[model samples]
Target chain A: MVVEVRLFASFREGRFKEKELELPEGSSLGDLLAQLEIAQKDAKITIVNGSAVSAEHKLSDHDVIAIFPPIAGG
Target chain B: MAGYAGTFLRINLSTGQIDKESLDLELAAKFIGGRGLASYFLTQEVDPDVEPLDPANKLIVATGPLTGSRAPTGGRYMVVTKSPLSGTIASSNSGGFWGAELKRAGYDFIIIEGKSDKPCYIHINDDTVEIRDAGKYWGKLVGETTDLLLEDTGDPKARVLTIGPAGEKLSLLAAIMNDKYRAAGRSGVGAVMGSKNLKAIVARGTGKLKPAREDECKSVVKNALKKIRENDVTSKGLPTYGTSVLVNVINESGIYPTNNFQESYFPTADKTSGETLAEKYLVRNVACFACPIACGRYSKVGEVEGEGPEYETIWSYGASCGVDDLEAIIKANNWCNEYGLDTISAGATIACAMELCQKGLVDPDEIDGPALEFGSGEAIVEWTRKMGESEGFGAKLALGSARLAEQYGAPELSMSVKKLELPAYDVRGIQGHGLQSATSNRGGCHVRGYLIAPEIIGLPEKLDPLSLEGKAVWVKIFQDLTAVIDSLGLCLFTSFALGADDYRDMFNAIAGQDLTTESLLQAGDRIWNLERMFNLNAGVGPEQDKLPRRLLAEPISSGPCKGHVHRLPELLPEYYKERGWDEKGLPTEEKLAQLEIA
Candidate 1:
């Protein structure tokens, strides 16, 4: 299965802005973060298919994932 | 009186009389300071029905109790007056060194009343005040006016706050530029200043801010500093990328309005995102007076360099106009600053005009400059300059979106609430932020109550953006708390790390007050109701508490948030109930009595 992942702000430093990753069918969001070498604590906002979700949430093929550090402004 | 300079200047521009008066401590305590106190003065002195550009409408520049104090990010001031744009009471806030300098000059605020027969500028040097001739500087761009004013004063250290040609011509979208780039940039406050024939204000102060409880102030300030340093949003995110960091965040969330909100997503948002700006154009990060966050961005695009292209500015000129040319957006941002125009309103207005042209309501032959076409970076940059100068058809664009759309007989095409243009966020997908924008005293504003913080950013805690539960309560609390922060002379960014109790402690220590957290919020609630009352008296009533027709009736055409429309009607009643107002959204007498408004 393949998932599209996007990164923003400082989280993109050294890591790619966006990429597609191959993972097992039963992979969780946490599994994708680990594969990307991102600590669970640093991923303050995690979204799957545009809905915010916890790391333990299940992911499937073609799911769009985005992760960001704690960021805000008006 | 320790936190306050305890004095203010009342200048009658009509008669050239400058009277020095002591601040009323009792009233100051009731209203807090800055926006709250300034609104109190405006409501009392100016008739709500008066034309906003009339000399009868006074421009009150006010600093808060914590302004120039040891509190982190305390350098903020408000330009309060009747708004020509929305016809509601306008209080536009700006962060920069000028507010702190004004406080240091032994004055808490300046009230300029009446109209001057000749162009003039106010010069304040500690105790000395003069209304100097400003004929030579009239009609100049903001940067030139700032430099010319500094030369005339012979004090380069003096801070300059002036209006550019947009204000001089009374463009409804004009902004008051201070420190050359920082702006009290909404509600057409600059037009009010221009209508009074006042061009600029220069201040260079040598006095010091005296905190009432010096020992308590030190400890409280230290605690604030520590929390700010520890917070992720304040200490890292903002300082690292500035507000433009949100471009990707909002775009990914699918609520980023594009092409005047004809769509809710921009595919190439990353091209204009903060990361790209830092990589390509950023010169350095700039900080306001005593600011630790330093979220201000100074960027260069070829030979033109200036502060910002902030999150809203980028969205307005980048995504909102359907233009992904980052360099062109930077140039347009510079044009806005130089011409003293609100970048959000300017870009959003152009976006509105593009839609009108697309629908054939606006004739292409009439444009005469750039084609009113989406994705044209040339249109965005050139239209912005023309709008500021009010040149040719740009004069109609200068009237802002609401007027422009109505003139073309497609009033619904204008993406605005009241007469003010909405910002970057597409409220159709964010319910709470939508409700806040609908009911904002100043129309279509985000900063009044940025529910986007919890809804999208997950600051403090995250709320499901699609959910409708507890949103009214959230909106009320956020709006109230924001009023308190604005009144205290502090930046809203501080609220991400500091809570209501932190603000309470700082106020008590600095102003020598015994305010509990509840009473402190109650004061904010009072300010909120007071503004509502002023708006009501101005004939901008509950009927105006609505989002644009497109937003309320149309769903976002595509994106992750597809088929979602703002649930404003469902939430407005609950909001009114939370605000202790009647069903018509008017404040009840009992609520006013509880808040102790005279």
Candidate 2:
């Protein structure tokens, strides 16, 4: 299965605004993170469409994933 | 005194008498510091029935223990006074080096009472305090006054808070500008300063604020800074774009309040977004006294290079007024900062006038021949200067939105609560935000509650923004947590990444007292109730805790949430119940007892 990922702000600076990645039928969030070419390991991730899921939770096809960096402004 | 200066300076401007009082440990333990301490002093000293602009009214400047320390974002202070705008208790917080400097000057707070016979500035050099004549700086802009004070004091690092011509003219929406751009900018605190004939306050302190247990506190501070640097939002998004980054994100979510809440989104939002500002105007990044994030941006709007407007300023001046010209918005921001005015209130007031003009309720002659049309960048800049200087149309605008609408025989059209104008967020689309705004102690304000964390940004947790269900509970929790953070003098922005437990940890480390999460929240609840009590005693009640008729009756004409109206009536009951208040919005005796306020 393939899923779409969206990144914002500095993450976009790294040309990671959108990505198409292949995954197993039921790959966990941890598995997807391990497979992605994201340079930073401490990046915060948010699933924009799906429920708040942990790294161990499995993902489905067509799930929109949104990732962010730390918050700074008030 | 692990985290205190051990003294409070009291200045009676009328007699030009200054005295120092020792900090009371019992009050410190009960009220904490900053907003909490300021409220305590206001309640204890100032009479509730006195006019906010009268000599009897008092202005309190307070600093928390964590302020001026190595704590991340510790450079914060609050100005508490009887607000001329709302005629109720008002506490306006500011982020700058001034707060930290006060703490370093061997004083936890400074309380000014009795109007001065003439214009003067308070000068405090560690262990020494005097009220000096400020005749030269009487009508100067905020930036100019700050420069003159620093030069006269011969201390480049001297922290200053000064009012501009707006305050000198006693404009109802005047504010005190500190550290150049950071402001205690709500509810006419600057007017109170003006009433006291205070033009500025300059302080220079060489004393260090060392913690009792330096090693432990240093470790805690280091870890917190490291955590902030690692946080994705603080490390990259905020530092890179500042708060203007929210423009695109909010606009994308279809909750950007445009054209005086007539619409939920702005079409030209991208033109005024952080990305656009970074590409065009951004010159450098600035930070408050000890802030490590450096989220403050200094930008060049045309030839002027200074502190740029933040997210709220952009929305209030740009999108809210239907103008998308970033440079014009920047210019308006500069005018407000220089003139010592609250940008949120000033912009909102102008937006209200523009809406009146669109409805044919206000004549062009009333606005000095300008059409006062939405999206007119030139008009915004022009009227803003007029308002700051209290000239012509600006004189009417200086009366604020509520008064302007009332004068036009359309008070309901004013998008304000208790006379104070609303902030950037449109409550029509964000339900919880509406509840918070309506119930704010100082009238329509976002800082009092800020339900946007869950409803819009989805920080810590996510919730449906359109839903009214559970909104009452959400608003209560956010309000309590925010009260705790504000009283402790911690930057409320940290709540974006840190939770209640994280705050509790820091509070315990700084005060050298063990504080459980429950106790901390209770402290916040106590502070909230105390503020409410002050307001209620000052004559604001259930009638004041309501949104304008337009928000409750009129639906959005277009957008994703088109035809949506605020459910304030339906939510009010639940909100009161959650807050342990009655229908009159008074804290129940039982609730007060639980918080130990009784």
Candidate 3:
């Protein structure tokens, strides 16, 4: 199955903005982070299929994942 | 007030009388300083019922103990007055060297009251304070005015605060530009200044601020620098991307507040994100006095160069209007600074007009000279120019989003609270921020509390952005702490890594007090209630403490936050309970007594 990944802010630096990767049938969000070379601490929040979930949460086929660093502005 | 400059300057513009008074130690101890002290002074000096731009209104330029000291990110000050836009108490803070210079010029604060019959500017060179003729500089833009003032004062190192055509025209979105680009930008403080016929404040101070325990304060400052360096967001992310770093994070969180908040998502958000700006337009990163985190951007877009398009500034002009052009946003941002208008209010007002035009509630021709439609960068720039001049179509736009939306008979479409325009964050994704907006004394402001950090960024602790639980308690905690930080004349960003205890220690070392973190928080509460009371006396009630109807009724139709509305009703009750307020959300007698507000 293929899952789409999106990177924002500093995470996008020296990396791709959007990438699609093929993965195993039941890969957790952590596996995708490891695959993308994104450290767990560096990823503040992981949004999978539009809902924020923990790293242990399983990623389904064709899931859209977004990783962001701790960022806020006003 | 021993740790402070130990004096405040009072200028009665009506009589052209300037008096320097010793800082009241009792008042300083009670209100702390800066925002808190300014609020107390505003309520005492100016009646709430008076017109905001009237001669009777008072503007308090306030500093804090940390100001001008060797404290990290301590070069800050706030202007407090009744808002011309919101008709409520407003406290707008700014950073840069001007605030620190004011402190060093032998003043903890400056009170400007009454009105001047002729254009004037205040010059302070150490103990020398002069209200000089500003007739030549009156009509100039902020940049030129600053340059002329610095030249005329014969102090190249002087820090000048000035307003441009927007403020001179009494436009509701006017901001007071300090140190060229930094501003006490919101709540129309510049309009108040313009009404007084004051154009600039130039300060050139040679005196140094002496902390009570110099060694202890230095130690605290070093520790603060260490904490800031260790924090990824402050040290790396902010310095690298400027404030625009949040562009992608907020958009990804599904709460970017695009297109006058009609949608929570903007497909072209990436086109104007921080990553894109840094790559294409960034000239360099800059910092204010004594600041380690240089989040300020010195950028250019095809020779139109200036300081920012800060996170909210860009978001206000970019996704909020669906204008994906980075150069357009950069131009719009620069225009706002040069002309002295609050970008958030100006852009948000433009977005509101575009929506009104789109809805057929108002015609495009009524806007005068442009399509006034979303996604048009040219329209954004043109209308911004008009708003600055307060001529033709810009006159109505200058009234701000609330009045403009209401003028079209669609008051509910304003996307504001208490008549102040909301910032870039759509409250549908963060209930705590919504609560903050609803209860903000100065209206739909983000800085009063900035509950977004915990909800979206998770500074001290993370909370589910969607959850309505414990938000009231958390909001109160953040709000109180923010008050303390603002009073300290420190950047709110430092709160991301520093704790209340850290602030307490630094303040104690400087102020010659041993107050605990708990007492510091208690002072914040007193300040909060005092501001609320001022608004209450002005006839603002529980009815005013609410999100817009769209926020309460319309769930986000798309994006990650698809099925969410503000849900403020569910949260306000618990928040009131936590605040020790009645069901009406007014501070109770017991609570006020506990905080010694009276």
Candidate 4:
């Protein structure tokens, strides 16, 4: 299955801001973070299809994912 | 003088008495400086029941130990006064070069008391402090006054803090502007300054700041700067996008307050986002004295050019007003800066009026102005100008949203806390932020306890933004820590890169104290409690610590935050308990005694 993942803030530094990922259908969100070489502790927020979820949650095909480091303004 | 100048400049405008007094070292150690020390003096000197704009009220501008030193983001100062808007303790903070200059002039704080018979300006050149006539500059705009004051003082490098027409008219939302654009912009502090018949303060200094341990301070500053550079949010995102970068991210989160918070999401948000600003009108970036992040934006809109429309201003003039025109938002920002107005209050107030007009509660003809339909950028700009000038429909709008909404028989329509207009974030989605707004010392300000860091952006923690569990615990911590930062005269943005440990090392080196992060935070807790008790004596108690009815009862209608109504009642009790306050939200006698607050 293929999914699109987006990164923001520090996560965008060494890694590409966004990418198309090819993974197994049963892959968990943690599996993708490992592939991106981002430690689970460092990734502050992970949203799948616009809802926050645990990193260990299983992913499905075409599920949009976004990872953001801690960010604040205002 | 190490870290602290330990001098107070007291001026009584009415009696024309000026005195330089010693700053008690014990008091300095207890209260620190900037907001902490200023709040201490305010509670001590100003009578609690005194009218906010009365001559009996005092206005204090203070700098902290880190100010003018090698500390990064040190060009900071704070204005503390009784707010004419909320009738509570007001502490408005700003960043630029003026506070640092004042410190170099050898004073930790300036306490202005009484009112002058005529318009005047305070001129300080090192040791020489004079109250000079300001007839020529009284009515001028902030930019004009700054330029004129520099020429008048014959020191082109002199920095000025001045009020514009809004302040002169005693507008409740008026702001005091410095460095041409930076402002002590919240809680009607400028109105108090205006009430004193004071127009400007010009500062020019030639001196130095001596840290207690110079070598240790230098090394700490270098390490701090390196850490700041290493932080992605501080070094890269902020410098590149400014605060306006939050638009897309916040809008995507479905918590961006739009059109007087009638909606939580706007399809046109991208039109006024940071990404668009950077790609379009951004000219360059600017920084405060000794600042490493340089999050300040320098931009232009057609012929008009100036400093900001940071995220708050963008949300104020753009989403809050139902106008997504970035150019218009920029222009309104320029107008607010030059006119000496608080853009958040002005735009949000006008938005309330716009909503009234939409509901047929206020006829457009009654406003004595054009149609106030949503998305009318022209109306937003024109109404803002009118509010500053105190003309036409702007006259009623100048009273701020709470009063205007009440006059229209719909007080609940105003989105505010303690009569102060809510800023950019619609608290409906961000649970912790909403609670913080309600309990904030100076009404509806976001910076008082910026839970947005954890609530929405997930800074340092990824709590469920919708959860209510353990929020009170974290909010108390954030509030206490923020009080320490504000008192230290360091920009709060540094929290993104540095934590309590970094602050403790720098503070200990400069202030000659062996402080752990725990003790530093205790001072912050003391400061917060002092301000709270001050407000209680001023008649703002737990009742005032509440969100507008619209937020508490009316839930968001669409987007990710849909059907979310603010649930402050469920959290306020816990919050008070966490702060060691009683059920009434007043600090218990034991807590006050424990903190050793007199």
- Which prediction has the highest lDDT against the true structure? 1
Going through the candidates in order, state the TM-score of chain A alone for each one.
0.95, 0.70, 0.92, 0.93
Instruction: Check candidate 1 and list the clashing pairs.
Output: none
Model 3 chain B: which ten-residue window has the lowest total lDDT?
Answer: B362-371
Best by TM-score: 1
Residue lDDT tens for model 3, B1-598: 5458989999999999999998887779678899999899888878889899999999899998889988898899999999999889989999999999999888999999999999999999999998989999988999999988888778899999998989999998999999999989999999999999999999989987788888898898788889989998888888888888888778878898988998998888888877888899999988999899899999998879989989898888998898999899999888899899999999999999999998999865576767888999998888898899888989999889888888899998888889989998989889888998898888999988888788877777788888888888888988899999999999998987799989998999888888988999988888989999999988887789899898999899898899889888888888888989999898999998898875
Of 2 and 4, the candidate ranking higher by TM-score:
4
Candidate 1's fnat?
0.75
In candidate 2, which residue pairs get closer than 3 Å at backbone N, Cα or C atoms, i.e. clash? A69-B232, A69-B233, A70-B231, A70-B232, A70-B233, A70-B234, A71-B233, A71-B234, A72-B234
The candidate that wins on DockQ is 1
Give each prediction's DockQ, rounded to 2 decimals: 0.84, 0.23, 0.66, 0.37
First chain TM-score, candidate 1: 0.95
Candidate 3 residue B570 Cα shift, in angstroms, is 1.5
Interface RMSD of 3: 1.6
Stronger candidate by DockQ (1 vs 4): 1
Ranking by TM-score: 1, 3, 4, 2
Q: Native contacts retained by model 2, as a fraction?
A: 0.30
Question: lDDT by residue for model 2 over B1-598, one digit each (tens)?
Answer: 7677888899999999999999986678577788888898898888888898899999999888778777788888889998899987899999978998888888888999998888999999998899999999999988889999999999898899899999989999999889889989999998899988999989888888777567778777777777777776767778889988777566655567899888877978878878778879999988887787777889997676788789888988988999999999999999999999999899988899998889999776666745689999998888889999999989989879999989998888788889988877767778999999999889989898878778766676767788898999888899988888887777887777677877766767777767789888877888888889888889887778898887888887775567778899899999999889887677899988987777
**Cα error of candidate 4 at position B364, Å:** 1.7
**Candidate 1 regions off by >4 Å?**
none
